[model samples]
Target: MQFANQTGGNDFTLQGLLNSADTSVPLFFAFLCIFLVTISGNVIILTVVTMDRSLQTPMYFFLSNLSFLEIWYTMTIVPKLLANLIIKSNNISFSGCMAQLFFFVTFGATECYLLLVMAYDRYLAICKPLYYSSLMDTSTCLQLVAGSWVTGVLTGLIPVLFISHLNFCASRHVNHFYCDIPPLLELSCSNIYLTEISIFILSLVVLFSCLLLTLVSYVFIVNSILQIKSNSSRNRTFSTCGAHLTVVLIYYGTMIFMYVRPHSSYSSDLKKFISVFYTVVTPGLNPIIYSLRNKEVKMSVKKIAHRVLPSGFKKTQKNVKSIF
Candidate 1:
């Protein structure tokens, strides 16, 4: 009956909170606070982007999609993580594991590609300012953004299929918190030759392709920055990308820490820590990133806040309807 101990069978055990260090009430509270912040922050971003007409450009359009993706991304992992932190013994059903794996892979891959797309947008804006609008038209933008989502989702399904095909004979105790590829692959009882190769190829595709794209965009952006005639012009251009660059540093730095390297060097705790940055912190920070440097987002947020502020603040509907 015990799957963790079963030999060449599908019996697998998920890891528990206590299995990791510092499984306590305070840790649970910390995670809970993070979840609340992530949800609220991303929602605010979506609202601000949706409400603002000035922000209706291809860049903000992609950002809104990203914000939506972030909300779902957090939803996929955080609730279960919160539950696991509170539950004495954390266990997930086979189907639950598969579902978690599916969304996690999909969203993680989507975020990576989305970031790359944003980089490319910045590159165009900087390297070819005159043609930026023409090149990054609405339909083209939609194609890139929508393509990233569908591609990530479809590729994500392949891994889940392989995971389902695996005959799990050995210990099913996933060392990491969530349903991750490496830990799941480690538990497979069947000879995973095809799965292994498929994952390797796909990982290389997702990891290297996006990373190279981002890097190339930055290379061109830097070249563009240097060629600007005036200091103020350069500063203005750099400022536009500053927040996004900060985010890219944090997101890609952490991602490359695990994904860009050989898998054998991986540490579970290290992986968990870095994954938390992209999966948990990135959502909360994204709203902050897009809103902080952006005047349109700020003005829109102020208007939205004015509209939504609790009953005591406003007289009401007569004059304000026109401004919105």
Candidate 2:
């Protein structure tokens, strides 16, 4: 396969979701809608958490950070994806591809750490209720959030540095929507044994380590909940974790399937679908999941809605005055 412009240039042509022009318009609109929803949902979550004093707790603080990460994560890939759907030539500059790979990995890994942190926060809240407040104070929460970002950036940087030195000889078509490590590695002309091993090891260290911590935290959380005498009390405590658990299941489920396995086993089409689901779909669904399931978030949304809608607030006030 004669790679396009392989003489001296490093430009890559992305073989996006569907190569046919007939499907482009529909796919473009579909992804456009997904992008808008992803942006709007995460933005609202971030806005509501920032504006509402009621949501000024450790849980929501972590949530806001997650929202912030999701927004950037979606932006890193989806816009380019949408463009690829519409445009025939999905040529991305070498530097642009590297930048995309960097941010995509950064946000993706950051989310892993953030989710783990959120799990630990939930564990502390449920298992150690008496000390939850003192232990997860504002400073501590900030530190955790900061640590996740730092860790993600560092972890993501390692792979990018290794991949940068790789030589791509002929085939420049990346068989995915984004610059994922596996596909990028597949395109390398250099002997990728060390690179593949390094990526696998790094992925295991980052993804599985976080997964283990999250599981351990939840195990203790479940144990503590089981000891509760009142069913209502146990249910209420469990409800607080319901949203995070749902997100973790979706996020980790797609991620582990994509990254945890050997690159040789990855079917290009299947990996593309999975990537879209996690990168595009999950971020959009996260705010919806939290808002629908978490009563606290729902209540906060209503409170903000009331504050925003004058007519509704007036009617509510009139009802209250009549009752008085």
Candidate 3:
């Protein structure tokens, strides 16, 4: 589409970056700091999972994968986003936009599935203690992780492939920090009915299926907790699942609010704000949330510290000593 009064590339002129309303130097610096922490936090979790022998269990295995996913998830958006916030021009090409969407979809799907697996694991441990070891064995764990990745990659790519084929000559500006499906849909120059239906169905299946599984798992877990005769054991059991529940609540709450609602509720600003919690904040905090609140992870950290600091770093070392 040529320019109206001017020359070529008028209607299809490449777009540029859009930053926060107060995209000042201070805000830029603040976001930069947040990004750094996100990276550093996930990295620390990854390192702990890798080096700490006590953390070689299925739970830690999932956590390690999660840390890795968060790293890649943030990397997909933060660099270009930060650059766009600071620079005068923040234009991402069509190919670049599609690539970002692809990755975002993948990581999003992976998180959904991983959380389901975590919930199921929790259920097994709490409700079926005798079967936990046999159920979440190495082969089973490997299959779940592998299936999460595969499903995420496929679902993420399918919509991207279908949507990108639509002509986007009308407008190129995306109002959010990165290229997302909803924002991208707003730019389509072709019929999006089929695409919308397909994505809607896919989203429902993935989100609802996982939500149902998690809910059922928690129900069983709660029942088991109630059955415990000892208050101390009950509290200890609750503590083990508390962090996972918190993370799940924050994640599903934001996601359901964002994507699972009607289009009438759609606001790019609101979407961007909500997106921060799940995409940015959640990843950054998951490691700390788990390790800080978890006895096992805390114990693992202590073991690592004590073992690494000198020799004979007994497991009895205080968690406070491991935080450093």
Candidate 4:
């Protein structure tokens, strides 16, 4: 529970964001702000989608799920990073490291599958408008979301099982901000050829496979857009898909680069830099990207702002009148 610096026989030390004392305070505040904003943005999305009945469709449904995922996904890593930065200690126990690794992979793989499902939902709506309702009904959406979470849990478990059992005699210090596969593998004294191969294949399946399917869905989506006669309609459709596409490209691009390669080829500095993207930057950007680019979301947000702002202003005005 405590982010201690002392390492025992099985404990490993994480090399947090930076080593310089000068940067620690600034970095802590910076990360704290990012964490707060990310949480607030995602929470607002969840609130808007849940409260606004008009926004309760398949698209918003998946989006709410994504917001939920982003919340915990960031929670799994950012809090620890914040702790490490402020505490000025990077030590994590063997069990603690494995737990972190497990949850990180779970949320990560879940995001991959969830993104795929979101793409598929868009595909159904755009490509098969008439059948979209019947095809992606409430039950179907729930099943897809549930499956994504379950699949992510299973995907995360495998690598953790293998890596946890590995002998970490070479070094007790991990070279990155968190307990990641490549850094852990680098520390192992045992033969890690099999472990690396297993991770590579899993990445191919979870990360690359989902990405390929998402791209294919977009292919169909693009074709559907081109066939539409109204320029405005076409632009509207593009705007809808554009936000999801942007998220897909950024999430998958960073993920594939981070996971799909051989562990031996990983550069410590590069790994840390890229880790910041998926871990902090992408999650922070998701709600903003979706809300700003999405008309329905924007409208709902406006409605909420209208209701809440007026009530608060009225209360403030009453307080000012009483003071006078």
Q: Best by TM-score, which number?
A: 4
Ranked by lDDT from best down, the candidates are: 4, 2, 1, 3
lDDT of 1 by residue, 247-320 (tens): 87787777666554435676677677777887777777787676544667666766776778746335433233
Model 1 worst lDDT run, 10 consecutive residues? 1-10
Question: Tens digits of per-residue lDDT for model 3 on 1-324?
Answer: 621221233322223233435654665676688788778767767777788777889888888888788889889977876676676446766677778889988998899999888888778877778988998999999999999999999989988888767776445667677887777777777788888778878887888888888988988898889899999988887876776788888888887776664364665667788887877778767777765556666666666677777555554464355553
Model 4: per-residue lDDT, tens digit, 44-70? 789989989999999889989999999
lDDT scores in order: 0.76, 0.82, 0.75, 0.85
Task: Give TM-scores for every candidate, taking all chains together and pairing residue i with residue i.
Answer: 0.85, 0.89, 0.86, 0.89
Q: Which residues of candidate 2, in runs, are more than 4 Å off?
A: 1-9, 236-243, 311-324
Query: TM-score-based ranking, best first?
Result: 4, 2, 3, 1
Per-residue lDDT of model 2, residues 1-324, tens digit only: 344343365688889987678988998998899889778777877878888898888988998898889889999999888888876658987778888989988999999999899889989988898999999998999999999999999988988899888888577888888788888888887888888888888888888899889989988998998899999988887776666677788888888888776655656888888888888888888776655356676666667767888669867655434422
Error of 1 at 141 (Å): 1.8
After TM-score superposition, the amount by which residue 241's alpha carbon in candidate 4 deviates from its true location, in angstroms, is: 2.3
Quality of model 3 by C-alpha lDDT = 0.75
Using lDDT, give the best candidate's number.
Answer: 4
State, as a TM-score between 0 and 1, how close model 4 is to the true structure.
0.89
